[model samples]
Target: MMKNECSVVQDVLPLYLENMVSEGTTVFVKEHLENCSDCAAEFERLKSGRQIDEAAPQREHDTDVITAVKKKIAKKIFKIVAVVCLVFAVLFCAVLFYTGISYPVTKESISLSTKTDSEYTYIILETKAGKSLFFESKTEDILNDHNEVCGRRIVLYNVQYHNSFTKNTSSMSWGKPLNDEKPYLEVIVELENDTLQISNAE
Candidate 1:
């Protein structure tokens, strides 16, 4: 083969080394390498015995490619997780802020009134403004003082002006009114200097 032809055969040496060429191409390259001294030396250099085994270099190359792909996949997963966590954190803070601003427990946020039916007392809360705040499940027993253990108790916290519910003062327990066909019970809901005093407006 001419010197130029020898160069072309050298270019295909890697595929021949991996046994990846057709039988005819392999025979042609083999004949050129046998006659070409420079190509023979280059092939011998590629076969230098530094591998752990006869085929370890191929395995090592595949391992390197797999490792690179794994690193890229892990980086993408980390970015996705970070973005999702950031979005959830922002949403949580927004809901907390809205609840703190919209549902503040202030003297004006609550009002006490006797329903026209006179059989029930209403704990009017701004949270239930213009909505039916009563449920059949919330029977008179919910307001019965005699059924204290089974009945409901309202635990209120002393909140500072412009403060969040999370920063409210220690809680205090109060027994709810017993609506026993009479609204004569004295209703007192004291919060520091602000007391909510309501009576049966006779």
Candidate 2:
């Protein structure tokens, strides 16, 4: 009878190896395999076969995880490169705008002229390059006050260059009488030496 039981256990060993046996059957098979060498060897053979099937899917799962991680790293790298390129493009455009809109001019290359309109007096500056800048003053007294720079030079605050529908234009108004809200170029002038100095305000 025990030999017949060993044969029955061997027939169901494959299901036990695959973990498809009921709990009671699993307990019975484990007890029989422990006592009988023949059934134990048969169980080892079936277990080895099932392990091959199990290992293949595990390897496939590992491969999928690796592929997913690689894709995530690739997406992050692409985003970083795109952001760096965008920043570089913006800085390049700003440099181009600065070069196109603003240039250096000395007092020798510029002449000042005054014109009277319906509301105010316009102080017009003509450059040797035929570029012009204008400033408005309510009275000649305001203009005289701004022009008084140690009796030797005139200091113009916030001299701005414009490059839009009208090209090669600049402007500055007297600060005390009326203030003009516009961007300014970073250039300082010394009338005594007739020099123009360029600087970065930032």
Candidate 3:
């Protein structure tokens, strides 16, 4: 009879520890535990085990909180890195745009001269120190009222650019073979705000 009672009490111990048993069942289990040493010891062990079981969910909750914090920190770091890279990319493109475009040079910034030999006439062009020049020349047909070509016009211009990588130079010269048959009727220098007529046949 005592052994059977012990089995019944032990089976009910879990429910009793969790306070799920009815009032009558609670009274019976307490009475048995007080009288029986073995059942009392079993109840103590179950109580300790129940405490740990209840604490497990709290520990799991703490771990989840830690993981969530780590993920947020990682996302913030990624955003900072992406923003830094975008800034550098914009600066690089700005530098390229500044260096790539060309503009007509002001007349006050350059000196133009001419040197002649038997075969050719050299147009000597010079820029200020630390600047570079881009020279261009073209010829246009001079027309009369009837639209007939009377002569040719020679146009000359210079554009300038400066950067750290460009060679530091002050002067450049170009020579052209003179055509005796169609002697240059006029030579015009195109400046930023004005035109210079260097030579005119008329």
Error of 1 at 89 (Å): 2.1
lDDT tens string, model 3, 43-62?
99998988999999999999
lDDT of 2 at 139: 17
lDDT at 140, model 2: 17
Total colliding residue pairs, candidate 3? 0
**At residue 53, what lDDT does model 2 achieve?**
88
| Backbone clash pairs in model 1 (N, Cα, C under 3 Å; residues 3+ apart or in different chains), count | 0
For model 2, residues 1-202, the per-residue Cα lDDT tens digits are: 9999998998888788778899999999999988999889887887788788889999999999999999999999999999999999998898678545744445665555444445443444454433443322221121234453211123443333333333444444211111222212223344434645432212
| TM-score pick, better of 2 and 3 | 3
The parts of candidate 1 lying over 4 Å away from their true place are 1-55, 102-109, 115-184, 189-196, 200-202
Q: Find the candidate with the highest lDDT and give its number.
A: 3
- Model 3 gets an lDDT of 0.76
**Candidate numbers sorted by TM-score from highest down:** 3, 2, 1
Clashing residue pairs in all predictions, respectively, total 0, 0, 0
